[model samples]
Target: MLTKLLITDDAAFMRMTLKRIVTSAGYDVVGEAANGQEAVDLYKELNPDIVTMDITMPTMDGIEALQEIKKTDPNAKVIMCSAMGQQAKIVEAIQHGALDFIVKPFDHSRIIEALKKASDR
Candidate 1:
């Protein structure tokens, strides 16, 4: 079966861009969220195979959402997305059980590679 993915970003453009990339790469675009809270809610409902989460957002940030998801499902596969210079937050996400991270504006190859790695684990 195709890998299922939930994409979370505060920017609608980013979510749309990511959806295009993941769908073209053969992943099923299960859902998209404009913020971390929505991401968490969709996660519970969809149970996607992986999540691409942006680190900065209103109504809850990616790290908090990642933590919440991990609390509910320790094995949840999350790949954090962050702008350059957010190294500390990225590190924290990794420590919180994120499978991997991709820098933005995202590179197509890196996004695919991160998804592949997360799905493999």
Candidate 2:
């Protein structure tokens, strides 16, 4: 089965770019969210196979959302997205239950590889 993914990013362009990459790689995008809170909500509603979450967002941050999602589903699969130079947040995300981290400006190969790795875990 094609893995279902929920993409969360405050920037529309980032969401669009991720959607393009994930779809091209044969994953089904179940939903999109503009913030971490929405990501958490949609994660509960959609229960997607995977989630690509941006670290900085309005309402809540990705680490908090990742924690919330993990609380709800301990086996939840999440891969954090951050811009270059957010090492601290990336480490926090991994500790908070993110399976992997993807740096922006999005690279298709990196995204695909991350998804594959996260899905396998």
Candidate 3:
């Protein structure tokens, strides 16, 4: 079976771009969310194999959502998405049970590699 993925990002363009890249890579795009709260809700409903989560968002940012998800499912596979200069938050996310992180503007190879690593764990 193809790996299922839930992509969560506030930016419409980023979501679309990520969807395209992962779909092309042969992952099934199981769900998408615009913010952290939505991500958490979709996570419960879809129970995707992995989540690509954006750190900065309007409501209930990625770290908080990651925490919430972890509380519910300790083994949840989450790969945080971060931009440059968010080192503190990235470290926090990792400490909060995120499996890994992907630096944005989304490197295709890195994204795939992170997914592989997260899933392998």
Question: How does each model score on TM-score?
Answer: 0.98, 0.98, 0.98
Poorly placed runs, candidate 2 (over 4 Å): none
Worst 10 residues of 3 by lDDT: 112-121
Compose the digit string of candidate 1's lDDT tens values, residues 24-111: 9999998999999999999999999999999999999999999999988999999999999999999999999998999999899999
- Candidate 1 Cα errors over 4 Å, as ranges: none
lDDT of 3 by residue, 1-121 (tens): 9999999999999999999999999999999999999999999999999999999998889999999999889999999999999999999999999999999899999999998898788
Each prediction's RMSD over C-alphas, in Å, is: 0.5, 0.6, 0.6
Tell me the lDDT of model 1 at 35.
92
Q: Which tens-of-lDDT digit does each residue in 1-121 have in candidate 2? A: 9999999999999999999999999999999999999999999999999999999999999999999999999999999999999999999999988999999998889999999998888
- Steric overlap count per candidate: 0, 0, 0
Please report, in order, the local distance difference test score of every candidate based on alpha carbons.
0.95, 0.95, 0.95
Candidate 3 ranges with C-alpha deviation above 4 Å = none
